[model samples]
Target: MRETLGAEDPSLEVTDLDAATAAPGDLSTLASPSLFGEPRLIRVGGVERLSEAFLNEALRYVESPADGATVVLRHAGGVRGKKLLDAVRGGAGGGIEVPCAEVKRDADRSAFASGEFRAAGRRVAPGALRVLVSAFQGDLAELASACQQLIADTTGDIRESTVQTYYAGRMETDAFAVADAALAGRAGEALVLLRHAIDSGADPVPIVAALAMKLRSMAKVLDAKGPAARIASEHGMAPWQIDRARRDAQGWETAGIGRAIVFAAETDERVKGAARDPEYAVERLVRFIAARGGAG
Candidate 1:
């Protein structure tokens, strides 16, 4: 809720209930006119940890709140916490809940990314938005921070390549991106990002494992002949993602994907200890996959 509100109003007052110096009675005292007779806007925050006495006082105040006071309560969504939340919900009349869950949907992530860039007085291209979503792992806070960092580090419109370059270490160049590049027939770009992942400290073994997972997904989609929607629903994948996999699956038979998965497993084992130069082993695996795709 704070994040959403902060996006609109930068003058939001945030107070930690654990560190609040005043009690509910303090609201009345604070809102009282000073020697100069000037009016003030009082907004009490952090009622989640209010003491029993303070809670009663606060509840009473909310029952008939002062004429121009706004009280915002932040509570964890729990059965015990629901009492205070219900009080505010039943009385105070306005509030919003900010669930502490990571944003995973592409649309939500894109909106968050776009909002962050726009807030900083910059524009991001559509392709760049997808790149940001892919790289940032759908963490809204991290995406927001990345946008701010980019705004501070560079000038003008931020591009996809720029985001990739500046956020190489911060971003996860995981096998998902590698699979995306390879399945799209951008083997050169796939190899480049694979190297970037190695340079950025991702172990070759896990990279191989990620590749194997991608191959397995393709194989699953290939084997399923039911409705794409039903297949995607069963597999917990977006329809569009499943659609892309279906298109990519056309180029590879189930046996071919099985071979790729086996290759990935072998590469994973080799990278752990068998292969002297793990980088070379990974490159060979990538080349073999690309060649197989080309052959198909």
Candidate 2:
């Protein structure tokens, strides 16, 4: 969400629905241009708890999304505005839905954790990672946080005992978080999350998958001569995805993007057991992508 917001308009007004005096009418402010004609990002949090008036405003505004105004309505899911959500999701209203679904199964939670570490260029044994996930259970965010803490406190391979000692009762992280940090070239931060994730039991395959998706988006649009929307349409991706890829791909040359694709393929093989150490393979992949270069 932050990535999309930053890409569209860095200068935005953040208004929580609970705090806003005119929650419904605030949509109008976004639709109308500023006196100085500056573009804006108008983010409204807590759409799930929106009052009747606020819901109405959202429905009406979504009918014709404001030009040059990014109105981000965050819905955490519920019964209050099911119709409105359906309308928006059905594309009766424009904009995309980035779902943050809850992780239910142990396998899924483990996969999530592994992806986190793989993205950050870290390695942890599969057994250790599963133990970490069991410790966190239902709190994915905390699991990811624990991954970062683990990386900060330890070095080299993260072991099962490490997960037992530090994150038995606490810790957290996510794959998207990993990709964001990596693409932004913040290797240290990414690695911290990566270790935490692997420790918590995220699967390396999904981590590789995330990197592949990001690189594929970057490759599809790189040097493609057209409007972003048109290019995205040609590539069968959402405009926002293209927009995000463009922003994340900044400072990356065409060759770098290509090389990342190759690394992504190799990592896929390694994570699937082409190598003895899937953890090491993923770590290498993360390092290469984060560097935006091929192996020297």
lDDT scores of the candidates, listed in order: 0.64, 0.70
Candidate 1 residue spans exceeding 4 A from truth: 3-10, 13-130, 137-144, 147-159, 169-171, 174-181, 184-202, 223-231, 293-296
TM for every model, in the order presented, reads 0.51, 0.43
RMSD of each: 8.5, 16.3
Residue-pair clashes, model 1: 0
> Residue by residue across 1-296, what tens digits does model 1's lDDT show?
44555555555443323303465566555544456543344444434445666666665666666543345554433454455567665545454444456456655676777887887689877656656666676335456667777888988988878877876554344655666676566679879988877777777765676567567768878878778778866876555556666776767766667777788888888999998999888887787676553332
RMSD (CA, Å), candidate 1 to true, equals 8.5
Number of clashing residue pairs in every model? 0, 19
Candidate with top lDDT is 2
lDDT measured at residue 244 in model 2 versus the true structure, 0 to 100: 71
